[model samples]
Target: MPKIQKRKIIIAKLIVILILLTIFAFSCDSKKPSSRGIRISETKTYEASLYRQNCAVCHGAEAYGKEVDGKQVPSLRFGEIEKKTDQEIYEQIAFGKNLMPSFKGQLTDEDIWRLVRFIRRDLQGKQQ
Candidate 1:
């Protein structure tokens, strides 16, 4: 190979390495765990917004379930969440209960999980 070509190839490789290193460092640096120790930054924000928009109306805006369609959905604030597994809550939300419609199509798994965490955190034991 020509000397200049070799130099160019080496430079390109160096640039790629630098980029990868920067990405790794940035990710590792910001990866400290949150209060729940989940090590996820979006969990809190995404969950809060999701709850506000999708759950607030029927859940009393605090995950304290409200009377809707003549049926009362149970409260969801704090330790009340401890009673159900994340999967269980996910199922209920995604599939819906009676008059409620499923949200599986409207939301992604990540968004649902974030909302689950929020339910467990903010309203689980708030009124109890």
Candidate 2:
């Protein structure tokens, strides 16, 4: 084949590789800053909306914790919980810790992660 054909093939392969890496990175359970940057989308007003629909009931409208069934869930709106490691938070969400129920069946991993992101960056310490 001609030199141009080889270059085109190489470029196509590179594009495909990048796309695959993006998918893999997000799907990875161990994603970290070095491995994969968790992208908090600029279009996250929708995410805050989701939080209201799904999490606000228990975590409170502002994620400042809520009382359900006489149990008080901690405020996820910042404070210590806001800065906890993702693994710790994920584990709590996956397996009901204390009064908070596990959201494993109710939400997809992405949805849970988005809620986490909203609490961490938006609601947490944010002045509305």
How many clashes show up per model? 6, 0
Model 1 stretches with alpha carbons more than 4 Å out: 1-44, 78-81, 125-128
TM-score of 2: 0.55
Q: Which ten residues in a row have the lowest lDDT in candidate 2?
A: 33-42
RMSD of each: 14.3, 15.5
Model 1 Cα lDDT, one tens digit per residue, 27-96:
7884454333232223456667777778767766445468987887666653455678879888888888
Instruction: Write model 2 residue lDDT over 36-128, tens digit each, in one string.
Output: 122222234777777767777887655667788888777775467856777787778767776668889988888888766666666553332
TM-score of each: 0.54, 0.55
